[model samples]
Target: MHAPSQNREFLGVGWRFPLQVTPNGRIAQARHEQRIEEAIVIILSTAPGERPMLPEFGCGIHNTLFAPNDSRTIALVVHQVRQALTRYEARIDVLDVHAENNLDAPNLLLIRINYRVRETNAIGNLVYPFYIREGR
Candidate 1:
């Protein structure tokens, strides 16, 4: 008897869509980085203690979202982002996290992150926008 040759499995990072199902009622799946990106987005958006089971989980930046856009606020965000990623995400090595107040929209912020994918050793960046004190 011979063993079947198989490659590494990647079920993705998040939920599945357009679930695979046929007359036989079998499940279908996909593999890619979109899942990982989605997972990171979710992790970044979730507030700490929002997860009943894991009270310490999440970036917890929502609490400071209303803070004025200033050097202090930016520093807080950088600290929080680094803390959250360091605690939650083990897939990538975070290189840098920066926040820039929008020039045209003072109540907005642009956060940039530089990271290196651990498994493939690929470098990538993530830009997340934050709306501060909206409609104020």
Candidate 2:
């Protein structure tokens, strides 16, 4: 059997999203599952056309920014999340995507995604807070 670290090699290693520099003056990196999670975040957080070279990249959820807080809008957000992850993150298989309104914050929507790592069959989930309305 391969070592724990070696077994996770298929998940890949990459620079952390938002780009950080370590105290040692080296670029920060994410490995294995952490790298996959961060990739999902980057895919979902970015809007289409936001990247100059990759205009088609990113989730479509940004289009719902002005959409009303209702079942229809929630469904759209779920769809966007699923579509983006399926298209951008090749390391995992998307199992489900759902969204709920934050009780204390009317403008906030909590998006939950359940996924399984394709190579290792490891299951994971992430809850991303999306703001449909800009804070005043």
Candidate 3:
């Protein structure tokens, strides 16, 4: 069943994803901490020019896929991610942003974010997967 949109502003934290209407006829929205988490996903997933009226609203990591993954490049990425989140998401206070390689996942760069929910002061962390492939 599609979840119904409670268009009304909710004071809670977690909710369903995809923000789509289910087969039952309802809109999915994030609620508690999940709401904050999902917002991060949306921000990082969005590429510049993808959102109407918010042309500068994405992490733009995808465009940097081919850059050499050296120390300098990685530092730049961390800065960009931090800047994008700081600019677009007002719900969380970013404490730290780190980029590290996942030994098990050679093709991905894990972006770790430590942040606090501004409303509740609840601290949390999220690891966003950034794909990386060796250029031929």
Candidate 4:
């Protein structure tokens, strides 16, 4: 995978999402990110001193069609998440999302997506850890 976008900052992050999937494209990732974004928006919109937390979000993987050796689905998910995060003026870092087992449902997968406000400073030696979870 490519280096995590430099615009986003990582301050130690992790996440958990329900392991559930249907025939349609996986919704856990999308739903998880959406909820996180909503939560951040709600918090940031509050009155001064009312904001409960800084921008942050996470999720877990459920029934997936990818394996540890398969990078296609994983890559697509990363790209999708990256694009989605951009809408929130944020980015995902240290993302680790996948199923623990390769042959079944109800897998306990965890995703640690670090969220941060986008930065304009594009000049610097920056390195972000973009971790990807897989079947193991």
Candidate 5:
């Protein structure tokens, strides 16, 4: 196998989100692009003040958890996501952020994020599902 480039090394590796342990007794790690993607998910999933040491280090979208599934709410979510990623993930340049309603699951909001890896210029996208209403 080829060796990872310096840029890829700069991307860094970290323990996988949810903190899984491998069979060999080591923490599962996410590398390079996968690491960046996981970081994005973590940022979006966490709310400000959720991390005691880093009180302001998360997306503000969680504040709208009970917001109506309407255009105004969607716009706010998009803005929050863009702002959060821009602030936290210095490795990426956010290209676009948009949200769509899940017709079959009315309470679900599907958020799509398009970004470019700054070091390698690689393009990536991730879809994060946000639940606006609790299921019955």
Candidate 6:
């Protein structure tokens, strides 16, 4: 099951991952810090796989320095997160960002971004593995 939408609103400081959003006013985020940590331990325990999806970044995992609001950062974090979901090989949606400022405190800036994931049908006959299996 996917993460709950309400968790997304919280300020994700630690090892939280923002997922999708529901039809209502809820947001989705994941708290897989422990699981990811364990995965890292296992990955490091081995001599590394031939074709590892994630590369080592000192501690043992890849892309661990990504932040929501960083200089020279624009949709890169969301893109990386979406790319990792290719296991389902679904089509990823564009990230939408909206910056809003309070009228009382006009200087205070607040950014609200939404990154949605969608699944689309694959093209070509490769979708069907069976060739000619008929018993009629």
- Each candidate: RMSD to true structure? 5.2, 2.4, 6.4, 16.2, 3.2, 20.1
Q: Point out where model 2 deviates above 4 Å.
A: 1-6, 134-136
Give candidate 3's whole-model lDDT. 0.78
Candidate 1 lDDT at 98 equals: 92
Number of the candidate with higher TM-score, 1 or 2? 2
Q: How many clashing residue pairs appear in each of the predictions shown? A: 0, 0, 11, 1, 0, 1
Q: Name the candidate that leads on lDDT.
A: 5
For 1-136, candidate 1 gives per-residue lDDT tens digits of 3322232134243344435565777564444545455556667788998999998989967777778788988889888888888788777788899989977999877888887766666677888787778434
Model 6 score (lDDT): 0.31
- Please give, for residues 1-136, the per-residue lDDT of candidate 6 as tens digits: 6555434323223432324565785664343332232332333233223346644211211332332233233244334323333322223233443333345553332433333433221121111011111122
Best candidate, TM-score-wise? Answer: 5
Question: In candidate 3, what are the lDDT values of residues 6-102, reduced to their tens digit?
Answer: 3323435444666577688877666767877888888889889998898888887867787766576678879988998999888789999999876
| Ordered list by lDDT, greatest first | 5, 2, 3, 1, 4, 6
List candidate 3 segments past 4 Å from native.
1-15, 20-25
Clashing pairs in 1: none
C-alpha lDDT (0 to 100) for residue 123 of candidate 2? 94
Task: Give the alpha-carbon lDDT of every model.
Answer: 0.72, 0.90, 0.78, 0.35, 0.92, 0.31
Model 4 scores worst on lDDT over the 10 consecutive residues at 120-129
TM-score of each: 0.76, 0.90, 0.79, 0.27, 0.91, 0.23
lDDT over C-alpha atoms for residue 36 of model 3? 75
Instruction: At residue 128, give the lDDT of candidate 5.
Output: 97
After TM-score superposition, the amount by which residue 73's alpha carbon in candidate 2 deviates from its true location, in angstroms, is 0.3
Give the per-residue Cα lDDT of candidate 2 at 40.
Answer: 92
Quality of model 2 by C-alpha lDDT: 0.90
User: Per-residue lDDT tens digits of candidate 5, residues 22-102?
Assistant: 999999998999999999999999999999999999999999888888889999999999999999999999999999987
